[model samples]
Target: MMTALLLFWPALAALLVLLVKGQGAKRVAFIAALVEFAIALFAATTFVVAKTAPQFELSVPWVERAGISFSIGMDGISLLMVLLTTFLVPLIVLSSFKHDYKKPNAFYALILFMQTGLIGVFVAQDAFLFYFFWEVALIPVYFISAIWGGARRVAVTFKFFVYTIFGSFFMLAAFIYLYFQTPATGIAPHSSDINAFYQLALDTNTQSWIFWFLFLAFAIKMPVFPFHTWQPDTYTEAPAQATMLLSGIMLKMGIYGVLRWLLPVVPSGASQWLDVVLVLSIIGIIYASVIAIRQRDLKRLIAYSSIAHVGLISAGIFSLTEQGLQGGVIQMLSHGINVVGLFFIIDIIFSRTKTREILSLGGITQTTPALSICFMILMLGSVALPLTNGFVGEFLLLSGVFQYNYVFGAVAGITIILGAVYMLRMFQGVMFGTRSPETEVFADLTFNEKAVLIPLVIMVFWIGLFPSTFLDISEPAVFNLLNIIQKR
Candidate 1:
């Protein structure tokens, strides 16, 4: 029952958002998100990582004939992922209070609706339910970007929608194929149970098809390198809140898909294509990093940096090693926290200065010391400075990749240097350069803005200083997954 609420409560809150008038929608939605986060924390205390199979599992027969169940559960991985979703949603809602967008009810409602889909994706144990929520999560972002986005929102959002839908088509087709291939029992004609699907013994040839079909969807969503063309434009045009959803949490969907669905379900194919995928991921790291260095548009720079960061995460996951998987898990939380902070800072800057061009503004630090300090902390985390949040994950991830192959690890590790170069450079341009006329009178962070940023700053060092706290929660799940891959 509690597990079900984690999924449905946000949905209920979204409905409430629709009915509530004016600013009440934001308050009610924010409270709902807070309550939801509290429930997730409770579940965390209750979850037992030693038991590898899902806990807090709630399964109800949904399509009896097809052997589908309304099954949702949490293991260590599911728990952490769901926790990340709930933890960030309230913050996302809180971050947006400053903007009184048109029809505020609809805007807040869409955010809560998106929260529902995100939470649903993490807990779902049945493939059909997972797929349903995957698309469910996509719908709100489309509307959020399309309706509330900047000038080219319509066009950029259209392209974004088309690309993702194209990927989802392949994903759906792959699932349909898997549904038929799913082993059936006297209890049902076919099974869409995720665990049952894992028991199938398919030839490497067939696994190859499944790998690519699934990869097409996951890759596009991660917007991995070549598939990532839609991202910068989308991020640039979309409102900061929507971009926060996209980078901060939504993109994790693809990484989660790769870890949960692609790797275990088809180990043979994963091993076979591991080299190819790793190469592509490595290329994306350098490719995106190079582009980020050249970008003058602050939003575009972060967008590209996001791609590079995810590229490294992708390489770690495909490494299929213990360190890689664990690092990926650790990085997921860190990336979400840091990226949200960065985007929020950018949003504040744009709101104040009316420009996102790094070259257009200077000496922000002179006036907005608090904001500058916050930016410095987040930027350091982004660049993975020692004893910072980014370092722990990147260190573990690189180590994992190194164990997989020295050459691959070495090339992928380039981001450590490149990320610092560009990030510090961007910081220098925006915060510390000579105070220009435009930035001379900049205001420091307001109370609401501090409320949004303080938590992020705390998290940066919390994870940086005591990463083991986060890692301990995810380690068991990561090992459980590696065990599945190895035993297969």
Candidate 2:
């Protein structure tokens, strides 16, 4: 099954790299990421060939008395997330080769460690295991930003750490409370199996509070609405490679949590307060989109844009229709790819021009047409232009919302046009106008840069042109999920 391979490869990758000497470390890191990618691909192939129900299943007791086992399984959703994680880590590692960091070994090692934690989160079938992996995933980021970030690294990183941890504490308490309520298993208080968690029945009043506690953790992770204060600073101060990891793959953890944890665990509560969640999500979408229009820094603009998109995704989840949830899942994958591509473009621009301030640059397209073209495609993908990956996901999401409530769908619909405005504004400010002294000396993309981006560009068209390839894979799983929630 390569299930064990999936769990250990990154850790093994990190260990081997640490044994290597200076200058060899980057190569080791890159090779490690590549190997992990291969293993993940092998795992995916195995899943398909076996036609396994909970594909690639592995379960072993980690804490037997507590009914806590190291159980890991992947349906289509987890499989897709693992694919995104594997795909991006290698690119992020490759991107770092050209950049400078103070402690290269530790930096790369942490990246590998972060990969382990991320893969762990998706495959974890237990609640405690999920939270444990979740925290593990953030540790590398905290250190990466604190030790390797820009001028305000400490303050920015600290804020990021504290905000996330604060939210996490509430979740921890909620999980423990739920555990105690689980009929008092003989060997332990209760179990942490996430599937078992779905069976938990609680009053609406209790479910409402519990949902917020758990949802707060994810919302902060997604950085929805008022909880988003930590994102811009953290994104701006961190290195672009780190930012890629944060936005590209890490943010999906929140959406995954919403689908896998929140909706299933508290269906009644989710139904009862869905209107409030819908309002908040729509407001965040519009609010962040407006804020994006004002952003002078390209990274910050993307940061706000990510917030807006996630809010839209969150709204789709609250819609509670099969179509809405399906769209939400599809959007998660598409947005992950689009965001990764955008961050890579931003990193390339920074490398060439030594600036991320959108206002400080102009006429980049004149010298770097390839980079310009790539950026334009990513922008189109971001804005959900027709026949782009973004279009399929947003269309389904909007269709889902429209089916649920026209007023909600109509309000969220503004995001399509608003997104275009901000994305185009950012694109024009950076790529399109007359040449300026700052941009005059910029170089075009290298062979490696194009190599990293081409696959992503192909995916943009592949998904946009034929979304069913991905959508069909998600359908049965989403149906199974909705069926579970509806029955509950």
Candidate 3:
């Protein structure tokens, strides 16, 4: 029952938000998001970490003849992902209060609608259902970017749409193929249940091809390396709220997909391609970090930095070490929190100074100590400063990768150095030196902005100080997944 509520509540709220008029929609959407977050927190209380199987399970026949079910549930992983979604969303919506976009109702409504798609993807246990929600999640964000984005919104959004859709088709093909491979049962010859796919024992060759099919889909979403061409543009072009949704939550769908579906479902094929994928992930870490250092646009730099952070997460996951997987899991939460805060800070700077160019702004710290302090904390977290969230996850991830291969681990470690370089450079450039003309009268964070950032700042420390709170929740699930891979 709770699973169903978590899945559908955002959608219902979206409809309610649509009914609202004028700026009331912002309040309606925000309250609705808060209610959804409250429900998720309550649900978390009931989640038993000791149980490895999904709790609050709900399965109903969706296409009886075709062996499809409207199935969803929460394990440690799904719950954490849901928590991330619910937690970040209200902040994302609240952050939008500063900007009264045209058709505020529609803007807020789409955000709520996107939340449903995101939640559905996390909780979905059926392959078809996961795919359904995956596509559903994309639609609102696409519209959000295309309709509300910067001048290049059309071209940038279209490229993003094309990339994702192309990837989706590949994923669908992989799912259909996997569905056909499932054991014949009842009226249908195959099933789309995630467990059924997990139980499949495909030959090496078949698994190899299917691996690429699915990897292409997830890689594009994660925008791993060569396939990441569309990301920076989309992130830059989208509105701040839209960018938050994409970076903080949307991109995690791919990472979640890799953990939940790709690695476990195709372990043999994954093993076959392990080195290749790791190399790509490591390259992205270096490539993106280097690019970020040269970037003048604050938003674009953060966008590239996201690619680097995600690269490490991907590497950790594919390494298949206990530490690596756990690190990946915890890092997902940490990255989401830190990145959203960074982007929100960037948005605040852009809103006030009317510019995001590093050269075009400075000395904000002198005028806006609060903004400077918040930005510094979030930036430090991004660079993995000890006692911050980024450090815990990155430490474990690097350890995991090191366990896999010292050379690769060593290469991946450069992210920390480069990360610090770019982040510190960005911070120093924006907050210090002489004030640019645009930032001469920069104001401090407003009440609503403080409300949005304070919680994120708190989380940066919460996860940093005691990662075990989250690591414990995901440990059992990670072990269970690893056991499945080993057995096969």
Q: Give the C-alpha lDDT of model 1.
A: 0.91
TM-score of each: 0.99, 0.97, 0.99
lDDT over C-alpha atoms for residue 188 of model 1: 90
The best-first sequence of candidates by TM-score reads 3, 1, 2
Worst 10 residues of 3 by lDDT: 181-190
Taken over the whole model, the C-alpha lDDT of each candidate is 0.91, 0.86, 0.94
* Candidate 1 Cα outliers beyond 4 Å, as residue runs: none
TM-score of 2: 0.97
TM-score of 3: 0.99
Compose the digit string of candidate 3's lDDT tens values, residues 1-488. Answer: 99999989989999998899999999999999999999999999989999899999999999988999999999999999999999999999999899989998899989999999999999999999999999999999999999999999999999999999999999999999999989976997789999999999999898899899999999999879989999999999999999999999999999999999998898999999999999999999999999999999999999999999999999999999999999999999999999999999999999998899999988899988788888989999999999999999999999999999999999999999999999999999999999889989988999999999999999999999999999999988999999999998
TM-score winner, 2 or 3: 3
lDDT of 1 at 349: 91
Summarize candidate 1's per-residue lDDT along 260-299 as a digit string, tens digits: 8889888998889999999999999999999999999999
lDDT of 2 by residue, 259-302 (tens): 88888898887888888888888999999999999999899999
Candidate number with greatest lDDT = 3
